[model samples]
Target: MDLSSQNRRQVLQTLGIATGAALLSNTVSAKNAVLKAGPAFKYALNMSTIRGHRLGFIKELEVAAKAGFTSVEIWIDIFQTYLKNGGTTAEAKKIINGLGLTIENAIGFAKWIADDDTTRKAALKQLQTEMDQLAQIDCHRVAAPPFGATGLPLLNLDILADRYHAILKMGEQSGVIPMVEMWGGSENLKTISQVLYVAAASGNKNALVLLDSFHIYKGGSSVESLALVNKNAIKVFHVNDYPAGISPQKISEPDRIYTGDGVTPLKQILQLIKNPDQPVVLSLEVFNESYYKQDALTVAKTGLAKMKAVTAGI
Candidate 1:
């Protein structure tokens, strides 16, 4: 049927308005989905937690994939085993990307805070090597633990800070950021104050606060402690849950728990981070033999579930 020009124009305008309204609704739906995430669910399994499985890098990658984890943190030993067993860097990357996961940051022993020039240089070179490995995996950061320096009566805090700055300079050159972690039981930087002090000394933009759930607890710091840290300075958090029995004074470092399964103030701590948009990967970093005794998939799956439930309230 032929219609008047005015009627045709009016009908087209109505259709356009209706279509626009529907599009707006769809957009809001997608936005609500994202906000419902509230924050990213970048759950990762720490290989150390699943150490009972005795799985190496490739096997752990498979286990993580099967268990529905998109990423994991691997230790230096795992990577060494991978390369020792004819595992190529390219092959590892393919396995990771194929399963859609990341190497994340590694926990390695490096004494960048030392009094000796030779030792410091060696440490920097070691950091460089670690960064090279991370770069090959397309990872942007490495976790540097202040290990192997204890029992030496080391009073060179300034020297160590300087040394860390040098390592960070090297890391920056290679497009890697080195996060200085707080070792709860260390003589120095055993608490957040010390870690923050060292991190502040670097004065380099790449230096950051690497929060380990267990360490934070052991440091005698509370959930409120997160308020004191510069949100921008926090690189990422190493998430794990642990009971109070695992005191900072003892129990060694291999007894972290799945989130919400322990006494840690997980939700309050999570709520502490100022910005939700800043790439905070809630990596499930545990070291419990019990969790490892279960299937690696079970460990990952349970860790993810617990983390979700704990953070859900926040």
Candidate 2:
């Protein structure tokens, strides 16, 4: 029990404590660094999966938020219904913000590519209104599908490009970007090549094309074509699957199924989209009528689960 022996023991104890602290700090720092790198893609709900459930616009937001989804794509009709119920755009934005959800895009049908001048004018007017409404809620993206010409003959690609450029300019003026959506059943712009012609011919670098797995297959276009476009050209991608046994021509939007439930090569498609600058948002957009029969929360949770499963490796 000499003084020197006691001092030596105390010094050893202090050194042990110091070494442990240093190791703990280093471990935490390394773990945090890995987390900062994050995942390659973000997930979002398209709201169409629960369309049969009949939840109001606000309720839909609640369902998504409760199900752990941070992003959602809304249909324009749902927003209009909210307005009819005396809900203001500011209030809608507040509800979404309070729930910690972001509106990634809105589904809209603006026939901006119609050959008729009068029809085109009305479609442009509708676009302006929809874009303005979207801007109020701080959502700057809208889906521009060829609603009027889906069943008609395919229009000239060059003319469609001019129309796309014009609409993109209009969207720019209102701080919104109208993404040219591809419909598999549509007569025009059904293939990746056709969409590329319009998007490229638009001569606008910010031009975007909305893609869906179902539509891509329905249109008889190869899924591999997605690799040809720059990743930046696609802002939002709709994720869904269809039964392998069904012919692509026979499948409709209602036949859409949850991701990974069918035979769609989603993993391969994800590999094709190589954008290092930013993570692309994968929105689940299924119109399966059967999903509507389930409770809204269950449907949302189920959809989110399937989405996570398909993108787990990516």
What's the lDDT for all of these models?
Answer: 0.76, 0.89
Estimate, for each residue in 1-314, the C-alpha lDDT of model 2 and write its tens digit.
Answer: 99999999999899889988889989999898767766788889999988888888999999999999999999999998999999999999999899999899999888898888999999999999999999999899999888888877879888888899998999899899999888888998888888877899889977999888888899988988988988998879999998878897788889999999999989988878746678888999998888888788998999999898998867
- In the order shown, the candidates' Cα RMSDs to the true structure are 6.6, 7.4
TM-score of each: 0.84, 0.88
Off by over 4 Å in 2: 1-36
lDDT of 1 by residue, 195-266 (tens): 777788777777887887788877676667788888887656888877776556775666777888778777
Against the true structure, candidate 1 reaches a TM-score of: 0.84
